[model samples]
Target: MKSGTRHPTGYWAEEFMRPHQAFLAEGYQVDIATPQGRQPVVDELSLSLGYNDNDQKSVDDQRAYIAGVAALKAPLVLGKVNAADYDAVFVVGGHGPMQDLAVDPDIGNLANAILSNPKKVFSAVCHGPASLLSIFDKDGNWLFKGRKLTGFSNAEETQATFAGERVAEPDATGVPDRI
Candidate 1:
């Protein structure tokens, strides 16, 4: 994607939609956010027949599901969101967060604000956890030091790379060794 040619990628459809559906079932008001306030793109690969167990209907449902989410059409910009306004922050995963959320300072600030408070929750899956690399204290210390965490695994990335998916390597200097 660096040669001025863009390969489409964003939130993994099942990764996002499954959690979104669960939240709605619980009657929670879900608000979507992106680094720059644009509507999120769905990782096309996530909707392919191979990923969907060869079910075209499943792929269609995922496409329709994302399109119907009004909040996703105009998601809040991460910098503009007040962490105090929400009880939890859920970061969705895909190839996109490796480029956006993982590198945004606002994500670090937001994570700090949410995690510092015991009443709030912060969670992410797959590449979404890459954003945790952004969490740092005012003194530049990693806030998640010594905490047990997991994200997209090296083996998984290696497999994706073999499958021709472009994966960016994010700086992990601030992350705890346990990650």
Candidate 2:
């Protein structure tokens, strides 16, 4: 969660919920977590019907799915998570992550621990990738330095007119700078 009530885009949350639903259907237990184990807020713009991008059903489904999940109301504390207990880590995107996850040392440690497992898969989408900025290797370099990845780019945000607004940005530089 962000320091205050900052939140991620609603579309990003919906995108995450799709995979979460799939994993659950496949018998994978999904746990909602945050740096401080607080309930996450969703950006209002993301919930708008226009933002649904002509797929209102998807948004509706996501809302229904979220309503059924009790864990989202009060997630587990990220620092308390044992990486070994899960087979993978999925970071959901939203501007809110840029506010906290991007600079949170605990998130970096968690990512490092999860990535250290050869059998575990790590994935992030949209602004969710901002969390990657926190992970550093023993050499104090970015853990994902040479890896190929993509996320919400600054150009896109600029195109969307978020450049000078109050919207949250990443904590780093370039496409993934800190908010």
Candidate 3:
């Protein structure tokens, strides 16, 4: 989790939970990890009922999982993770990745290793793709250069109103530049 980034979009976290639960149901073990071995700080806005208005169950499930899951309570340190131990890597997006994962050398190396392996699957969602900025090819170019990708758009950021005020920072660099 990024130390300074906050106010993660609630919907994004909920989106991740769907797949997470599915994986668990399929008998796959889920391991939560962070750059450091500290508990991740979730944005308060993400915990609001409004985010899960249509399905209160989703919000309830998320809350229950967070409170009951031991892995999330003490996530593995990113630096200690070995790429060979996992078959896939899923990077969950929020405002957080832009702050730390985007530039963290350990995460960059891990993403690069996983992406380079033919048998391994590497995936990221929304702002999670920002972490790809740190991954470089052997020729020293961004690994995602020329690949089609999408994430939280500038328009969405500008249009988002939190507490009846525009949420995006006026001088905020667009997502492309941040990567």
Candidate 4:
């Protein structure tokens, strides 16, 4: 998040794990990928007691689950992986992706490959859809132009940013609040 907020931002825990668990449960071989093949930073805020509805067990379980996943320890390099080798490309959502995945040309190429293949699936959640912005057709236009897509919306972003912060009431400018 380029906004003035100093809070550390990274991939949301549930955004990455829930779908991953579902894929594994269905006997799908999951491969984690990163722009540099390194383990991604987890947003500690997402695991907080407040965020988890005060469920300490859920936080602990999420932490344990991540710690035990060997694939996360050494993910595949996005630039080096062959898109055809996988049946699906799932970009996990986070503030971090907006920094790298959304702009990386390698990711753009990979996304295009995944989209061109009918048998392959391309899916993302929350901020994850931002990554799709990089995908373009051969003519250099956005691949999903005019297509309905979902992602972390502006309203949700506002709520998340001010979740526990105190702010002044809206002024007469009709701009609501400034970042």
Computed on alpha carbons, the lDDT of every model, listed in order, comes to 0.82, 0.73, 0.68, 0.78
**Residue-by-residue lDDT tens digits, candidate 2, 28-123:** 999978888877766656656777886888678767777777888888999899888989988887677655687888888888988898889888
Worst 10 residues of 2 by lDDT: 168-177
Per-residue accuracy of model 1 over 1-179 as CA lDDT, tens digit each: 33446677888999999999999999999998888787888889999999899999999999999889999888899899999899999998898776687778998899999998999999998889988878898889777666777778767877775222443432365463322
Candidate 1 regions with alpha-carbon error over 4 angstroms: 1-6, 162-173, 176-179
What are the runs in model 4 whose C-alpha is more than 4 Å off? Answer: 1-5, 162-179
| Tens digit of per-residue lDDT, candidate 3, span 9-113 | 322565456677888999988897788866765544555677668577777777776667688679899988999899888887666655678777778888888
Clashes of each: 0, 10, 0, 0
Single out the weakest 10-residue window by summed lDDT for candidate 4. 170-179
Best-first order by TM-score: 1, 4, 2, 3
Q: Put down candidate 4 lDDT per residue, 1-179, tens digits, no spaces.
A: 34445667788898888998999999999998889787888889889999999999999999998888889889899899899898899988887775567777778899899889998898888878778767778877777665666666676877876332434233343222322
Scored by lDDT, the top model is: 1
Candidate 3 to native Cα RMSD, angstroms: 5.3
Instruction: Choose the strongest candidate by TM-score.
Output: 1
Alpha-carbon shift of residue 1 in model 1 (angstroms): 8.1
TM-score of the candidate numbered 3? Answer: 0.78
TM-score of each: 0.86, 0.80, 0.78, 0.85
Error of 3 at 104 (Å): 1.5
Q: For candidate 3, which ten residues in a row score worst on lDDT?
A: 162-171
Clash pairs, candidate 2, are: 93-128, 169-179, 170-177, 170-178, 170-179, 171-177, 171-178, 171-179, 172-177, 172-178
